[model samples]
Target: MALSEAEWKRRQEEEDAEPAYFGMTWGEFDRLPERKQQETRQRLSQLGATHVGFWKDCTLGKCRRARRCIGFLSEAQYKAGYNAAYPPCARGEEPRRAKIYYDGICRLFPEGDEQPKYDGRRKTGEEDE
Candidate 1:
């Protein structure tokens, strides 16, 4: 059933109140310990928080299909750009761009890897460890 207009507005307000974080909601991120949050921020900086272009057959979903580097930016900047493009409660199927972005980062910086690598193969049957 369709939500009432008031209910829709309320939800929009709630989404607006909570910021966006990659792979999770802002509220979830905020609930983490203060030190953990700081560590996360620091870690992103240490990794350079570079934006990895979408994989050829990205497992997350259909990619944006751009044939060039998407340009590196800080996490904050990426989040802002994502929100501007696809805000919360956006009507229709969820876009894959954000998930692609997150998955790209993970692939580039898999745990224990001394340096990032470019892997464009599809992760059809791979599981996150």
Candidate 2:
């Protein structure tokens, strides 16, 4: 059954009302400490390749949010001179917050040796007890 216009609108509003991250806005994320922001950026970088692939596939496959993520990424790439002929989104409704959230999430957790060690002992070069 098709949803009524009112019902669809209500659902959209509810989704919009939900916070993009832990009840915090993009402004809040931006205002976080430099270390925190860097941490978030590192995590986001870990997911960067995957997210880019998802956006590219979505663009080719015509996913619903494709216009938003793809458009934003394409525009950014073009602006950065990475691509010379990227097309603008037809819908013109970029996923502003979604992009910010994803980018922030990407920076959260780092990998490899960059990850912090939690050994409950003195420094490696320090004299042992």
Candidate 3:
């Protein structure tokens, strides 16, 4: 059924009020320091080079083990390894590092806001809230 204009406007406002992932929008991601952005892009590109193909194949139901992939052993398995190998930031707390890295990777692709939200505590002085 079609909604009235008032309902539609209210829904739009509610969506707009929703918090962004890691409390950051694409605009904020773009405004990060150039060095940080470059580093993030580089890390994401390297990750994509190594894993994107496999991930795509698995997601498209083209992999033999796609159905078996689950829980802690799922796609995040590679992410954990990547995080350990690359280590997003050297000077921040775990939560902050996770947020930065998560946001960094999310911003690397189109429709990034549709990516999963990073679940972590906000750093004391960061703008995330």
Candidate 4:
């Protein structure tokens, strides 16, 4: 059945209007409730998060919060962040706590390697033992 003319016009107007939550500004979009934010995030992740042909730009900030919940970044940016955080130990002391793994470990690095071996026995991170 056809919607009444008035009803159809109203639907068209509603479609033309910006979402009440998103309003015409990024600031207003940021003010949306957490529930709404999450919903929109999920929707964006589904659509904008895609890979096109050779011309495609994979760097769009289309992180999938539903999958990992940590947000997203291009692989290059990810590597830079990872390297900046876990640079080779400044003085060659084994990094006590790797930031990517243990952020608070930064405090241990300044303590110096001479402080003492953590345990009577020690092994490299890759060591089988």
How do the predictions measure up, each by TM-score?
0.26, 0.24, 0.23, 0.21
Mark the regions of model 2 whose C-alpha exceeds 4 Å error after superposition. 21-78, 81-129
lDDT scores in order: 0.45, 0.44, 0.43, 0.37
Query: Candidate 3 residues 18-100, lDDT tens each?
Result: 65435655455566785455445444433432232223323324232543211112235344553332322212145534543
Candidate 2, residue 23: CA error in Å? 4.4
Clash-forming residue pairs, model 4: none
Report the alpha-carbon TM-score of model 3 versus the true structure.
Answer: 0.23
Q: By summed lDDT, which 10 consecutive residues of candidate 3 come out lowest?
A: 66-75
Q: Give lDDT tens digits, candidate 4, residues 1-129.
A: 989999998876666564533244444555667545645543333232221111132222332322222233235543454322221221112342122233333232234557755666666788865
lDDT minimum window of 10 residues, candidate 2: 83-92
Q: Candidate 1's residue-wise lDDT over 52-125, tens digit each? A: 33333332222335432323333554455433232121111234444433554456656685766877765665
- For model 2 the TM-score comes to 0.24
* Ranking of candidates on TM-score, top first: 1, 2, 3, 4
Residue 39, model 3: Cα distance from true site in angstroms: 1.1
lDDT of 4: 0.37
lDDT value, residue 12 of candidate 1: 68
